[model samples]
Target: MESPTEKRPARRKDAEENRARIVAAARAVYASAGFDAPFDAIARHAGVGRATLYRNFPDRYALGAAIVEDDLCELEALAHEHGDRPDAFMKLLSAIVERHTETHALVPALLRGPGEHALQALVPRVTRLLTVPLQRARAAGLVRDDLTLADVIDVLAMLSAVLADDGSGRARDRRMARALELLIHGLVPRAPVGSPIGPNSPRM
Candidate 1:
């Protein structure tokens, strides 16, 4: 069952801190275990009462969504730190891949829950953070001239597909790293060779 969200007032300072702690704890537990890690485990890790944990998050899906929201905030800060560098987009993309390595368990479970919409809603915000970096990259010929933000989004989606097949281990880490390297290589600026992709290009 969902928690009642009607007519709620602002949380107190301690309540806000508790909420943050819960989310951070949930993230760590998820990394060590998976999204199915018990709510009590998260509550204990957060050093909050079960009631406080439930008050802040109704379920694992809510925790997963909250984690994503927190991650996006971190990404916003990271992109700002990169600050118009031509390689900012690549750095941001690499950071995202690393995050997914730790958080892949959330994707399949969140997709099964109502929090999928919450994840979808953040796409626009993510795009906004990515826009400046992508623009800088294209301007500096760091990415292909024809690359669009949508294409980059698609690349991220493809990366998410890799999450489905991974087991949480050193192998998973290496696999994700290699996947990201391959994706970035494809995305890097290419020399114009008279439409080498079309029918006029050499076979094989």
Candidate 2:
């Protein structure tokens, strides 16, 4: 007979696997059909029963938050990986813009008026993920001395709005690229290295 201990490990493994499948299916369904996509579709996509989907994610908002959390965690890892580079902040920002547009359509579904509080709940975690590379860039004198993390966050919010725009495909992509370039450029220091107005200067 199978011992209880052996049976418990198998059950735990199945539960974890089901949870991962549910999250992955949610990402695909949410990306293609918006957050209002039917949970039944997600369950079918994951090859799981409706019970498993609900077991993993009790509500649509919960599933949406899980997707955002995964994206944020990926962004945080990228920030940490590139944090020591002189252009770390811009690099991080560029990567974020790319990822943001890929999932832009779902933003309204996850963060619109009725769901605003869910977005509010995520702010601190997102901010913490962003601040590290930004501070590193500041310390390296790669950004203007006056730049703050709040400024970075505000710029990102504007970028997300741009991503959510419904213009023609090529035009929208071009505008997003242009907007990101301008944002990065605005953060660059005006003074050349070793100049009187450089980061070391009191006036900086």
Candidate 3:
């Protein structure tokens, strides 16, 4: 037999482990079946009893929140890793596209109806992570000066919408690349078109 304090610590550790297991199982199930995954199925997969699952996450919303938090952490990591690259705009754009594609269900859920304040709050961190490279691209005349951080957010949202419409990941990626290329070219200042010059040398 253990002392009371020792027993409490051990019980707490076990509860923590159980909670982590449940969260992991929920993540796998949710990724495969989206938010439609059954709680019983998650409990079964986690190898925990339904009571244990509920003890860890009382409802589907709690599970969804945990998954969203995990996804955001991953995004933050990616942002920090590639936020300073020479082609940071492209990197950030690609990251955003991949994230939106991977978390298709979650994105739509967060965007639907009200209670998007949490998601909205994350935009500034995203903007700061992206704006640095975007500004650099603008300074190099590689991107449009008229574009704002909000434009980047709009483009990301559009990309998510496109992915939702066309579930073909490969096709969507190719289209996104082409679209970025066009945007980049359009940003270049155009030279005035002089009078059409014929193949012949300048007429005397």
| Highest TM-score model number | 1
Q: Give one digit per residue, the lDDT tens place, for model 2 in 16-122.
A: 89988888888778767877788999999999999888888888877777777777788888877875676767777787788677667666776663456767887
> Cα deviation in Å at residue 134, candidate 1?
0.7
1-204 per-residue lDDT for model 1 (tens digits): 535553244346678899999998998999898777889999999999999999999888888999999888999999989887888988888888888778887877888889899898998999898998999998998888888998998988888887777777888888777787788777877646666666675331
Per-residue error (Å), model 3, residue 26: 3.7
Q: At residue 159, give the lDDT of candidate 3.
A: 59
Candidate 2 displacement at residue 157 in angstroms: 1.6
Candidate 3 per-residue lDDT, tens place, 65-165, comes to 66666666776787678656656676667666665566666757655634266567666766666778878777765566676778777766665665566
The 10-residue segment of model 2 with minimum total lDDT is 195-204
Q: Estimated TM-score per prediction?
A: 0.84, 0.80, 0.66
Quick one: ranking by lDDT, best first?
1, 2, 3
Q: What are the runs in model 3 whose C-alpha is more than 4 Å off?
A: 1-24, 113-115, 167-204
- RMSD score of candidate 2 (Å): 5.0
